[model samples]
Target: MTSTPPHQSVLDKPFVLDLFAGPGGLDVAGHRLGIPSLGIEWDKQACLTRYAAGLETLHADVSAVRRDSFESLPPEINVLAGGPPCQTYSVAGRGAGRQALEDVKGYIKRLMAGESDAEIDKKLMRLSDPRTALVLEPLRYAIQATRSPNRGHRPYDVIVLEQVPAVEALWERYAEVLQDTGLPDGTKYNVVVDVLKTETYGVPQTRSRAVLIARREGLGDAPSLPDPTHRAYEAKEWNRRNGGIAAAPVTQQTLYDVDAPEPRRRPTEDARLEHWTSMGDALAEPVGIKHRGRKAPFLVRSNYGSSGIPGRRGVRTDRQPATTVTGRISRFVVFEHLGHDVVCEGPRFSMNEAGMLQSFPPDYPWSGTAQAQQVGNAVPPLFGAHLLSAALGLPAPAAEAMREPWVPAAEEQRAKLRSHGCGAADGCTARCPRPV
Candidate 1:
């Protein structure tokens, strides 16, 4: 394993080391914020996509890297962030992690008591699904970085971890341990944990994630989750009087409205948030027009039934935020309707459109198989920017700045591939011929 130092221009910037990085979502957010980042991903296809996006990457299993006590990790990295795979904890898959939650907490206690990795691995191998043990990998890295004398003695100033909502209990446990263990400088970490609603952060999709943010007490003020920038979405009756096209909800109150409004004025915090973005708002411009021929209104119908009941599929109109975009997003169907009649129907969302709903740029280069799965598994870059900003004690980026499109230059992509010992023909692996 090898690690590359940050470029001279960015050497002074806060560097982020992302583990279990799937196709560089948080890294993209870091790039936009002028922070430097490197991602460690084991999936070959995801690594290919990361290289195409010109993001720095180390393609290796996190456990293998952890074995070396992450010695190859760059000394300049000050921020640690990752979203562990959540299949076992997700409702869509077998609930192995959820069933073994109590046991996992025991493992955390053992780690705190200074148990060897080999001992833990021997027990973890007895689990029905070994992936359940991966959740502790980040905590292990944190403990070693802070307590190991061989390490440069420079602990990460900020630590961020995210997973499925089912893992919120685990995050609570993490917060307790992190705050309990003070650094050698006599400063401890201040931590906060919450399950954030994606729509509240301006994402045009309705999804929830368990997030944990920790900041070293010596590093300025304590950290908290960023304030909501958008109102939460609520299900309202669709108005059939206007062909089922519901009126857009009011986002804020103007001075005139506040003075003469029949409705009571909302509190200051409520008045500050904008309306939750709807699916139509995100896909209306080019995706709807290009794919469906008109931007009027559409309904997305799930192909699979819920909870093993056939013909019990769910549906969402364009007026509402999209239901969670998942790996099986391609199986959904979109229909254009006129009152009581169905005018036309087409394939649901294009990959680009799916990315947009997740708050990725419209032109983000997606080059991997199971692309939808990658997008679904990733943290929305918009949400990540806010989290990163709050964790690092930096001002949140402007809403417009978060929406801006970005693409790497041709030369930049070539240089990134070369740095990873990959070329167009080499396909981004160790056995590939070195660039001349």
Candidate 2:
């Protein structure tokens, strides 16, 4: 049995039930807002990390957890947030999404029409791949609770979901289904879909996610989208369509480059936004000022291996934003561009750097095993913080943590952490600017 979290008062506290919760990203945001949260995750490694972080957990898979389980919860659980495993729908993966999604949608429609499991099982073939349909589990909870005779007890006040852009339409379809199938009183939910660019928020990575929000308050309780606090890209005019409340653009720059002059580059189609926090920013330590970017290499290329394997673009820690972090999270093998014989400087960018780029705290208690898989799959906590705030109709606050843990007293304590390379020590020097 899961231990119930201590509640000071149940009258007005916001409770979050996170399904498919990966290392408690949304849960961290909830805690910061004074909300109590519980996560249901299947991976033992990820659950270990969550437990280490002092979060409540039901170490079980959402697909296996029966619908009756939701009714077992105390009334305080008013908000439900989830980001189902996204590998099958990710662009990087061998996306069998076209066939998988159509089949899954057909299964959902049949289930809604009161078809028996045996009947649907016989019709659906890709049951072998579990990731395709885990998404429907959330909708099942909503519809079953909405149809319950207990009118005094509301199913939920709000529901928020985030996933890869490939799964956007499925979630939008879910919003449509919930609105169409109303409660006994005919009161429907207010739902909206927003595709968010993570850099627009504050994380250093240029990743994009599809977000869906549904509110079950009275009709007038429809929540407004969380306004952007920083300008990530240039906008012609300040309008919601151009990615919400725009501020000065925060473009890509490394922690080493923080003291350097601003970047000068030709504008893109949408006009580039502002300087996003860099992976280097998270690695900066208060050692006496270290040697900064000096001309080490004019051009570089990375991800070199077998001839059949396509090369992954090299990244400059000083300026260019990193590509999305994946489950494997390989180090980009750095090479100098002299046009004939390339010199290998060895790859920088450690697992901790990847996690930091994902906006996990430098000291976050990552379960110390399967480090690459754990960080790659986990949502960035800072990004999750903004989304949860937006769903609640309260404006999302700016990132609240300092760049790196700094003690005003002395530089004696080195940031104790694990990484693929010696992180941010004084001796090593490397540079990567955007290739022209």
Candidate 3:
């Protein structure tokens, strides 16, 4: 659910191309930044959600769509953003999934060696999981876009990709390929890859994602990643690494034991870094029907009646950030208060609250029946906004800008702050914001 940013560098790119676009999170962020965008999503359910929310989307399996078809679009369309499905690459599913990585890499190598799609698919079909190969779609688009047969189209100006941390090595591989490959006009890209924690950027959940940003080569200097604004855990690492000196020390962050009688964290060292919002803040107003079965009183997944430790099954008290809002968000039970014994129904997060945590409109017009899956799969539009802001060549935004709900720009408000004027023969304009 990562991608978005702040800035000294504002986006000059007029539009973004979101591939494997899930529920329009990236597009939502792009719209807020005055960048018009569209998404290509394969899932009918997510596309239904996209249409209900009034976000633009094209329904098609990203893998089934040919990259050459993109040549039909106007050359002005440039920034590319997407998060390919990561279930196969996620650490949570790593037992059989991890063991398949080597085989997956082998398949990718064959495809790289110019094997026919039919040939590779035949072999991949034999793997325990073929989804692992889907990770290469983004790279396929990047490589193809950078070397389009059409003479007039320019390569993508910026590329933003996100996935679970275990797939970072794949992004790093793509970065290497982008570095080594260039356009017919000698245009190349400067790429940066890193694993980021969404909570560090004001997300209520502590989800971690591997993010990649690639800017067309010779855009003055290389692209920089966005800086963090909120303080949850160790603002010091950010401050020291980025040469930032804050007025006060960062507040400590800790989660309370679900079964503990008292809170588990230390007192704040002043409130400067407490901007990290909690499950309490986002879910303050609940709208979903609470489950009220006394027999299954606030039970969490798998360990409904265990006395071992609450950590086995997280407590849904608002004291801490909610556990990663996975499909599992619906399995946990809620308590009325931090130390109260009262039990509340169903899941810890409603689909609306989950959307809010991911920086979507709380009441976004949702179209699908798999509410938790749709909510769990989105990038926080606020976070995507930050990543897009950085990709557009702006400096990281102050944390305060991210603390509240994101407000998008009007269509008429679109304006370019290019350092270099438009229609230049060389196509150079942006000034890179140094990475923090």
User: What are the RMSDs of all candidates, in order?
Assistant: 7.2, 11.7, 11.7
- Stretches of candidate 3 off by over 4 Å are 1-11, 72-74, 94-97, 103-126, 147-153, 181-187, 234-274, 285-311, 337-348, 395-436
Q: Could you give candidate 2's per-residue lDDT for residues 305-374 as a string of tens digits?
A: 3244433343343333445666546554433333344434544545555666677655555664787788
Please give the distance, in angstroms, between residue 397's alpha carbon in candidate 2 and its true position after superposition: 2.0
Tens-place lDDT per residue, model 3, 1-436, is 1224322343454578888788877887766565677777766567656655556555666765543355644456677789988787776665455677667666556655556666876786787766776777775665556556562545677889998888777777777656774433456689899988777677776778889998877765788887776655443443344333222111111122233332223475334444566655555554323311112112223233335554444333353455567665565554332234433344454566667666665556556677778777888777787788777776443333333333332222211211111112222222211112
Alpha carbon lDDT at 62, candidate 1 = 82
Displacement of the residue 92 alpha carbon in candidate 3, Å: 2.6
Best by lDDT: 1
What's the candidate order when arranged by decreasing TM-score?
1, 3, 2
Task: Give the candidate number with the greatest TM-score.
Answer: 1
Q: Output the lDDT of residue 217, model 3.
A: 72
Between 1 and 2, whose lDDT is larger? 1
> Taking the tens digit of each residue's C-alpha lDDT, what string does model 1 give over 1-436?
1112222321246788898989887987787777888888877777767877778887777887778637767777888899998999998789999998889999988887778889988998988888898999888777667754555666777898989999999999988878985543344689999999988888998888999999876677778898888887654423332222323211122111212211222464488787888887877765322233236466666644466542455666666688788888777767665444435665667777778888877667777698988888788888888888778766765555544555543765546664662434345555332323
lDDT (C-alpha, whole model) for all candidates: 0.72, 0.58, 0.60
